[model samples]
Target: MTVSRFYSPQSIAEATAILRQQSGCQVLAGGTDLLVQMRNGVKQPEYIVDIKEIPGIRDVTLTNQGLTLGAAAPAQSVTERPDIAAAYPGLVEAIDMIGSTQIQGRCSVGGNLCNASPAADTVPALIAVGAVCHVVGGEGVRQVRVEDFNTGPGENCLKRDELLISLFIPRPGVGSADAYLRFTPRTEMDIAVVGAGVSLSLDPMGTVSAARVAIGAAAPTALLVEEAAAAIIGTTLEESALAALAAAAGAAASPISDKRGSAGYRTKVVGVMARRAAQIACDRAQQRQRRAH
Candidate 1:
C-alpha cells in the first residue's frame, strides 16, 4: 500500500474541491471494496477523500416521487427500512446478498455500484428499477442511468474529479413489482455466476404492460435487454412469452469462460435466471394488483 493523505470532507463542496485540486485521489465510501483493493495493492492512491462526513450523503429519503439513497448509506440501514423493502423488494434482495451480516453493516449500495464489477449484485437490480446515478463535480450535477454508469470491468464513466452523490429510483406504479435471482456455487456469500433482474407491471386486464430485464455477470457490464422485455410486454406472461424472454436473454449474453462456469454455460444460465426472475416478478405483480383492487 502507498502512503496516502486522508481527508474527511464535511460537505459535498469540500469533497468536490479536493477531487478537483488533488491528483490520484480516490473517494472512500463504506470502504468495503476500496480498502480491500488498497490492502491487496490493487489500488495505491495518493489521497483518500472520505465522504462519510458529508451532510446528507449517508441519508435515505423516500418521497412520493421516488427513493433517494445516499452514496454512503450502509447496506444494512437501507435494507432494514420496511418502506424501502416494500417499495423495492428486488433491490432489497440484491443488497441482502452483498456479504455477511457484519459486512452489511459496513458495505453500501453506492460503493457496490462504483466498484463496477460485472457481477455486483445490485447493478442489475438498479438497472431493472430505472435507477439513476446523481453525479457531482466541478462541471456541475448530472443524472446518468445506472446501466450507462459502468463502462467495463472495474471501470466507470465518472471522471477523476467527479463524485457519485446518490442514487434516484423512480416509483413503481400500481400492479408493478420486481425480482432478482443469481446462480452462485454456494447458498450464501459467494459471487454470482449469472444474475438476472426483472421489473414488470400488469395492466388491469392481466396483460404485461411495462417491463425491464437486466442481466449481470454474463457481460462486461450489467445489460438492459430491451428484446427480453419486449418479448413479454404486450401479452400475458404465457409459456411462449417466457421462452422468448429466455431466448432473448441468452442471445444477449457475452461472457468469458471461467472456473465457475463456461461461456456457453453462463449464456444458457443467464437466460434461465432471467426467465425465472421474470416469473417471480410477474407473480409478485399479480399479488400486488389483487391487493390494489
Candidate 2:
C-alpha cells in the first residue's frame, strides 16, 4: 500500500477544486486516522489532500447565536474553550476523552465526524447538543444536523467533492446544562463500549423544559433517543422518571455483539449511562442557575 500523491491546498476553494478534479482523493485534516488507515491498508487513496494549511478553517469563535467552530479546529481547542465548557460541558467532556494530550493536539472535531466511527466520542455529545455541520462543495454550502451527518460506521453523508467547513453549536439557554458519560474497560485510551450524552433545560419553576439524549456505540450512528428525553419533559428530576428514561434509551439502542462488548452488556450500560448522564446534566443546570443568581 502506497500513497501515490499528496496535495496541500491553501484555500477551501482550491481543496474543493482538487477534490472535484481528482478521483479517489481523500481529504486529510490532522491525519490521525487517515494516516493509520493508510498504513494498515484499510485506505489507500490515490491523492491525499492535506487541508491543514487552509486558512479560515481553524478559527473557533463565540457568536451571538452560539459557538461557531471551524472544522479544522483541534479537539484540544474545543476542550479548552471557556465558552464551550460553560455552555456545553458535555461537549468538553467528550472532547477531553477522545485521546491523550498528544492525540488531542493533532485531532480535529471535523476529522472525528468525517472518520464516521460508531465509537467516536464527540458524535454522541454533539448530537445531544443539537450541533449542525456546515459543508461546502462545488455546488455550494449546506448545513446538516449532526444526528444525520453520519450514515453508518466509517461512512458519512459528505459528497465526493464536499468539504466540511465548520460546526454551529447553539448556546444552551439560561437554565440549561449538558453532560456526557461513557463506559469502557479502561479509564482512558479505550473506545467506549457504551456512551450517552444528555442536554436538558429547566424552567424557572424547576420543571424540565427541553431535553435531548443521544447514545453511541450502540447503533450504526449516534441516535437521538427522543422518547427517552420526552420522558423527562414537564417533570422534575426523580428516580422513577430517570429510570423510565433509561429504559426507553435502552430499548432505543440497536447494539450488536462485538469484540469490545456483548449486545446485552451494551444495552444494560446504555440504560445506566442514560440515567446517570441525565442526573448529571440536571445537577449542572441547577448549578448554572445558582451561579447566575
Task: Kindly give the stretch of ten consecutive residues in candidate 2 with the minimal lDDT sum.
Answer: 79-88
Query: Candidate 1: worst 10 consecutive residues by lDDT?
Result: 1-10
Residues 230-274, candidate 1: write the lDDT tens digits. Answer: 999998989999999999999999999999999999999999999
Positional deviation of 39 in candidate 2, in angstroms?
0.9
RMSD, candidate 1, Å: 0.8
How far out, in Å, is residue 237 in model 1? 0.7
After best superposition, candidate 1 residue 128: deviation in angstroms?
Answer: 0.2
Per-residue error for 270 in candidate 1, Å, reads: 0.2
| Residue 278 displacement in candidate 1 (angstroms) | 0.5
Global lDDT scores for all candidate models: 0.94, 0.91
lDDT of 2 by residue, 143-217 (tens): 999999999999999999999989998978879999999999999899999999999999988899999999999
